[model samples]
Target chain A: MAGNVIEINNLTKRYGKHRGVEGVSFTVKEGDIFGFLGPNGAGKSTTIRSMLGFLGYEGEIKILGSDARSGHEKLMKNIGYMPSEAMFYPSMKVSEVIKLAADVRGTDCADEAGKLCERLKVDTSRSINELSLGNRKKVSIVCAMQHKPALFVFDEPTSGLDPLMQNTFFELIEEYVKQGTTCLLSTHVLSEVKNYCKNVAIMKEGKLISCGSVDELTHTNSKRVIVTADGKKSDYLYKGDMNSLIADLSGKNITQLDITDPSIEEIFMGYYEA
Target chain B: MITLFKHEFKQNLKSLLIWSISVGTLGLMCVLLYQSMTEDMQALSDSFSNMGAFSDAFGMSTLGIGTLKGYFATEVGAVHGIGSGMFAAIMATSLLSKEEDGHTGEFLYSLPVSITKVVAVKIAACITGLILFSVITGIFYISGVAYLGENFETDLFLKYMISVLLMNIEIACICVAFSAFVKKNMIGAGLGIALLFYFSDLICRISPDLKDYIVYGPYSLANATEIFVGNEIAASAYIISAVLIIAAVVTAFVKYTRKDLAS
Candidate 1:
């Protein structure tokens, strides 16, 4: 279905003795904000690289229902890749780098680039080397998204952004999904993925340990209790016997309170501990 | 491929302009001094006696410096041909690695182009740049001869230029291959390999039997020197060297495309 933006099956990549990614499998629905959460060196980059056809791996990787390796040309034009390390020709100005990518991707949208520049709040005239690390990332993001690719495969996409820029980025990504674009957001920083991602894949040691909707993991793995015994703060369970009391009232809504939702991190941790 | 090629070609052309200006000035300056120094009859004789040993060592006088080809082979060839040839090699080495070093490999590889096409395009661009540099050298040779007047020998000029051009290509290809095999910036490896091949050619000159091996070096290409001077052109030397170049390019493409951008 055009509804499935990305699908992986038993994907495996080996770098001599080290396996880059082993038996990695996941599916990204069309317009889905798919978060890939893993610790550093757990093959988040490797999986993304394979899907992007940067490295050959032993697995079935299909992007937008096309085999990623064999039919990569079509996929490449539609996928915007923001690497963990922000990369551009140091000699090139930010706008020029964006233009060069536009040329390669064969997109005639220079006017739109100006608008993107305004939206991202990135100055395009600055040479790449002159930009701070966060600014460089902004440049890369602009270059990656200027063509409005159907899929955004962002590896550590918000690494160097300030808090304000990070919020703006989330808004833009949400706007993209509204237009039916798929997002495969890869990062070890799970808290960031929690707010935006609908579907989540938790990776551990080159393998997909658990995958589901963020809501499912949040509800099933961990939950917060709402106690209403008395008006005073001391009346509520604080520790020791209170823990057992909560366990006694487990799976019950004993009081009126907003249960603390489990962030992606807690669920990711639960995949191992559970 | 075309876009990246254009970019590389433009960058190299910038380097070529600087090279032509500096090397051409120094070479022409030397030729001017030669014209003035050779005018005195007594000085000419004294000069020959004084420089006989140096000339033999440099392949200068015996090469017939009065001619444009010999003048080019010694002066311009030494400066531009050998020096710029190595520069071209280093250029090829750095071209792809720059993408990796700058952390642009993910972005570059993610594009719709294949690595083989990228490598081929970069080499073609560099080759075109080398050709442009050669043409500049040719123009300078003509201008130098025009300045030197009756002392300039035209017979060997074209031959020597062609020889130097081929030597430059040979060295450039050798260095390109070295760069392709290794990951990251390989300007050092490229130069090291190129110098090794260059020195081996000089060593091979010590034995008549090893002369066949000199073509493997950057300086061993058949140019005007052999054809105009009645020396054996060493047909097999060119044939073997051409084979080596082709082999190296093919090997480079294979290795480069296969390797991951681990850096």
Candidate 2:
């Protein structure tokens, strides 16, 4: 049986009148790709920040079976974090930047970095300022993965990446998971979560509204109904029996009717609205 | 910590070079011009000394402009003093705040190193940069004096340079303290602080009533006229500078350690 790699309990952070996160609690098992789902301001980053010991919070957080804050420096040696927007000194080349991070970690990641750079198509000689957004993200990916950490925390890691690069990124992540790595992935793309993540926790307005296995959350019988009748179309999520839905719509001058299962995004939106 | 220090020092090395070279060259040129302006300076010195407060404010009366030492005091001293102060201020002010303002803290603070350690290393780097600036600028001034073959008191010049370095460290520490409290890069504020102390020092010199309070500002300790004429800087000025440096460093460390870094 796999043990929990990350356990956060009753985590709350507040600044002045602004609320960062409230009563957030969740756990990620070892070797699991845990999807953290939320909108732009839904406290995903705040939780990640607190877990990384970047911000002080009221509650308990344990990473790799040690207190997160007390053992931050030790735990960080085994954690790789890729921030939402990758930024580096404009004058430094990508290779220099990678070398600095490796030096900070006190490890020589040259061979792994070389492989990742080649796979990601990142130019090592180009200065950071000269690289495009996607290329910078690729560099960030290399930095995060080159060390082969036990846990990976990536926030919106694929926003600027193209489809091909995104695929390569996930493939790399999957390979790491195969080697007994855990990942806490925060993203807005629900399709990625459905495709790659086994478990998920959904947040809304600084609160975790739903959390469970991906199959449990998306296994509901609710289907999206799009009805075009009387020269007008009506679209909404329907949870009633299909016969009842058809009987109710039979009296209308229905030109077209389409019913399909709701994707994880729609299911998660239901929680947000609720 | 060493890696961070090296990176930070390299990052600001260009700015350091530009500032030190420009100010050092200016100081050297001022020293070289003394010989060419000897006759004109002699003619102006007598009248200048009789100008009362105007001469006193600029040290023309106390340190006469006819001699090389006095000329250097009244000219190169002011240039180097203001230049070094501004350079130190500008460099230290944005040293820490730019990390937050530019969103680089997200990268730095995420590393295994503690925030306290990072802050300490950065302050050390700032002080090291100031030391190098002093050394480079001092070499330029010494070369100028040596090349001219003029009779000058090396002791007084060294004392003045040491005091200037202390004054710069004082300003840099204060700005570093301010950097911890601010989220944006405050280069303008840093420059303003250097100018404010300078003009205040000038005002104190011009006004006899304000003379007793000269120790309140950093410029008093580095005053060219005072140092070149072998006048002792008030003991209270040194005490105050020591206190300010300690207090500012303590404030920066405490504030930054607990700060919720802006993302």
Candidate 3:
């Protein structure tokens, strides 16, 4: 069995009267792309920040079998964390920034950085101030992946990326996952989770609402129902027993009936409503 | 730690050069002005000394302005005192706060470095800036005196320069402590503090009742009039400066290590 790479238990953080995250717990197994799904104010970033030891929280968190708070420095050696917004020194060139990060860690990532930059199409000579948001994100992606860390933590990584670049990012991540790297992807895009992630944890109002394999969470037995009865057509999401849905519609003169699995997006909305 | 220090120092290099050059040029002008104003200064010296509290506040009563040493003390000393203090204040005040203000702390603190280590490196860089500022300004002053071919008291000059550097360091340490508590750059507050200390020193010198209390301020240790006239600085002045510097630095290190960064 694969060991757990990240284990967070009963994590709680508060900003005075405001809630950050309350009793949030989840575990990501090694080599798994764990999706962390939440809306704008659902505390997804808070959980990630707490796990990375950026904010003080009351709970137990273990990354790679070490205490998150006490083992921060050592843990960071194998962790590549990309925040929602990538801000670097404005005066430094992308290449210089990459080199500085590598130097700070006492590692020479010149070859890997060169390859990543080329693949990402990052303009090495341009200063950070001159780059657009998408270009800066490209630089951020290269910085995060160039080191080839054991675990990757990306918060809203695809927000500023183009569709083509987004595809390239997932491809790179897939390659890394094949090599046994674990990732905690925090995003609201359900399709990405459905396609790339094996397990998922959905957060709402600073609490974890659902967590399980992607199939299990989205497999809420919900289906899209389209029926035409008495020359009237209707379409709606149906949940519960298939027999109950069939029995209710049998009494009516149903001209046409269609049943199909609901998309992950609909299923995700179902969780929020539930 | 060295990597962080080097990066910070490089970022601050432009500000350091600009401040040091501006202040040094002002001091050099004062030094050079002594050559052209010799006769006029000699005539004004007696009248200036007789002017009661005004002359005492600027040290014109104790030190004659006709000579190079006295003129440098009264003129260049005032310029360097305010200049170096403000420079130190502005640099240290914005040192740590800019990381968060510019939203760069998220990038920096996420590295494999502890908060204490980062704060220590920043403090070290600030001290290095002060040292370099002094050295650059010192070169300008020495070059000016040499060009004028005047005989200056080397011992007194060295003592004055060292005291000025210490005073600047003391101001910087306090400003660093202030920086740790604030999220935004407090350059205005830093400048205000330097000016406040200066005015307090001037007031204390002019009033006999406030003279004993002067030891509590940084200006007490580096009074141009005192140093240029070979007057011994009080032992208490040095003791207080050391204590304040240590206390401020310790406070800053502790506060910064505990406080949440604005990421």
Candidate 4:
């Protein structure tokens, strides 16, 4: 396995008396799609901001082998961050904004930016204020991917994108990750993580509750077993091996039987409930 | 830093032009009025003298309405001073706080730049806007005076203009520093600071004893008439203004760099 691209240890951010994120620790290995899952106000944005050095916080965060707080400028050169909300100067055209971003990063990303805009169907001639929410999101995505940074930090990256565009975005991410670019995707949605992410960390109320692969998490949780026999219907939570479950149920003379693995949503809900 | 500075300068260009045009128009009107007022200078001066406390309240007690320099100083200079100061404060405050208010802070802060560089470039942009505004207004005022065939000392006028520019920059730095402290009410805070400084100067003028204490006000530093006539130049006023500006800018840099930018 490659080394960790991002390592956060005991990270905490508090706003006066309010808890932002407390003792949040996680790691994303190079070339891995790591899902950071949490509900709204679960400190997902807070943690992302801390990693970007946009806020003051306790504990440690290292990105690309440098401390985020002290080496943010150097570290950010290799990081492409898409914030939850896409905002730009209202009076500036999309092209102007993209050019400004490219200029600040000291790179010539014109070709890549043009290609991304074409792929995403974004109109760069119009002013930012004139664009719709989805179009603005498309602009943001183009800006993030144009320079082709080694690490990507996307905070609810597909919120405003349409279903079709969301699929395209995932494909783009998959292609980039195939090239060995690491990604940290923060979202409240479970299906995206389950489908795309290799590993996931579940956070609730500013605390990390679980971190593991999808299969491991689902295997550790109880499975739903359904049986219909003699005009009676029953469901059971089966935790043991399949052979043991079959032996225990063999005497029931089942007319119909269905065994199913729980969805990621169900396991996530269990974590919240716990 | 250069990219950020250019972006900020371009962003504030429209407002800078508007303020310049407004200040220039007001100054031209004041200059035109000066021609007619000069015809009945004695009567006007006597009338102002008879107004007693009303004239004193507006700082007309020591003004000589007969002279072109005094008339321009008391009327056009006062308007430009307060107007430019207010405009500078508004511009600086908005430039500093608008990113967070408009939700663009996240985008800008995420770039490959230090917070110090960002703040410094923005401040430089604000200073550029103020300079443009001051220069535009000064050109109009000088043109107006010349159009009316008035004889005025060009050197003194330039010195007075420089003083006003310095005062505006000082007021802007103060407001920009205050921007780091407030989240939403930046405009209000800026206006409050400008108004308070102006009123404090007014009170100091009305009360002889308070003059020593209110010397930090921009009005005290950039007193147009005092600088125009080559009368006693308050060197300490310039020193104090410079100190305040330096202190405010340092505070802004420190606070903004360490601030928890939630937006």
List lDDT for all candidates, in order.
0.72, 0.91, 0.90, 0.86
Write out the backbone clash pairs for model 3. Answer: none
Enumerate the chain B TM-scores of all models.
0.81, 0.97, 0.98, 0.93
RMSD of each: 4.7, 1.9, 1.8, 2.3
Predicted candidate 4, C-alpha RMSD: 2.3
Question: What does candidate 1's lDDT look like per residue over A1-274, in tens digits?
Answer: 6478888999999999987889888889888899998888889899988888778788799998799877777788898888888877777788777877788777775886787789888888788889888998887788777788899999998888999999988898888889878899998777876889988888888888888998776665245445553342222212234467557556654445544554546556666444
Using lDDT as the yardstick, the better of models 3 and 4 is: 3
lDDT of 4 at B123: 92
Model 3 per-residue lDDT tens digits across residues A64-89: 99998888888887888888888889
Question: Model 3: per-residue lDDT, tens digit, B1-263?
Answer: 88889999988999999999999999999999898999798889999999998898888999999999999999999999999999999999998899888888777876778888888899899999999998999999989999999999978998999999999999999999999999999899999999999899999988989988899999998999889999999999999999999999999998887776777
Worst 10 residues of 2 chain B by lDDT: B106-115
DockQ of 2: 0.66
Proportion of native contacts found in each model?
A: 0.53, 0.64, 0.45, 0.89
* Candidate 2 lDDT tens digits, A27-82: 99999999999888999999999998888899999999989888888888889999
| CAPRI quality level assigned to candidate 3 from its DockQ score | medium
Off by over 4 Å in 2: A226-234, A241-243, A246-259
Highest DockQ, which number? 4
Cα DockQ of the candidate 4 complex: 0.84
Candidate 3: regions farther than 4 A off: A228-233, A243-256
lDDT tens per residue, model 4, A1-274: 6999999999999999999999999899999999999899889999999999999999999999999999988988899899988998899999998998899999999999999998899889999999888888898888888899999999999998999999999998999899889999998888998899989888899999888886676565478788887768988666678888888777777898998876668777778778
